[model samples]
Target: MSGNTKIDVSYVAELARLELAPEEKVKLQEDMEEILGYIELLEKLDVKDIVPTAHAAPLRNIWREDKAGTPPGKDIMLENAPGLIDDELIKVPQVLPGEGMS
Candidate 1:
């Protein structure tokens, strides 16, 4: 990586579906070049003896004993629902746009 690094800021912006002003393009190009330069520096590090790990520190799952909880009564459940059909079933938005109709 060098000061004369060339990056197609317009191409990158297009790929990201972003419209950048001329000044913004220049700023983004410089930022992207800096980031790539940093990555290049990282690639030069000696990691042969270093162990690859998902995290920097050891991780363990905390366990807790499962306990049965009382379910809400039908009346309370109905009251909390946004909408209900015939006061018996929960009404939700149709998933498919124009299917499942005669």
Candidate 2:
């Protein structure tokens, strides 16, 4: 990928269903060229010994078996809340009380 070679910015934008302004098109062209140049540089690096991995970090399933159990209802959750009215909704304490401030 020669940096001197022109990247088809308009063609790429058309394929991606984009309507880039004149300034935007110029910026995108420059950006794409830089990106391609970086890729070319990476191609020159020695990666024969490096194993192919989906992620840079080791992926592990830190999960447990899903056990079938009865989940608590909304009513049960409201009962544990600080303020519980006759209505099903949980009433929370006011963030600021008028009595406290001058």
Candidate 3:
């Protein structure tokens, strides 16, 4: 890893929308260099014939029996509701436009 191979800390800060202090910039630069070195080491590994496995152990379906079941009636379902205006509506927190919820 050459010292001349610059890691643009300012560009990183801008992308993350972070306001890094001058001292923090120096620390982050060192950390980024170390991370790049580790990635470079990983790039040199040989795994030509290795098949990718999703889990460490052998996996099984472990699924439950799928069958149709009766659902509770509307009155029983709505019994625990704090604020139900009618049979059709359930009152909830007042949501505002442009608040990221919509």
Q: Please, what is the TM-score per model?
A: 0.39, 0.42, 0.40
- Over 4 Å off in model 3, which ranges? 1-5, 46-102
Query: What's the distance in Å from true for residue 28, model 3?
Result: 0.6
Write one digit per residue (lDDT tens) for candidate 1, span 1-102: 454667798997899899889999888888988788777776567788887889877888898889888898888879988988889799888878987642
Model 3 lDDT per residue over 11-31, tens place: 989999999999999999999
Model 1 lDDT at residue 38: 74
Error of 1 at 31 (Å): 1.2
Model 2, backbone clash pairs (residues 3+ apart or across chains), number = 0
Clashing pairs in 3: none
Preferred candidate (lDDT higher): 2 or 3: 3
Error of 2 at 63 (Å): 9.6
lDDT of model 1 at residue 95?
73
Q: Please report how far candidate 2 places residue 39 from its true position, in Å.
A: 3.7
Tell me the TM-score of model 3: 0.40
State in Å the error of residue 57, model 3. Answer: 13
Ranking of candidates on TM-score, top first: 2, 3, 1
Candidate lDDT (C-alpha), each: 0.82, 0.80, 0.81
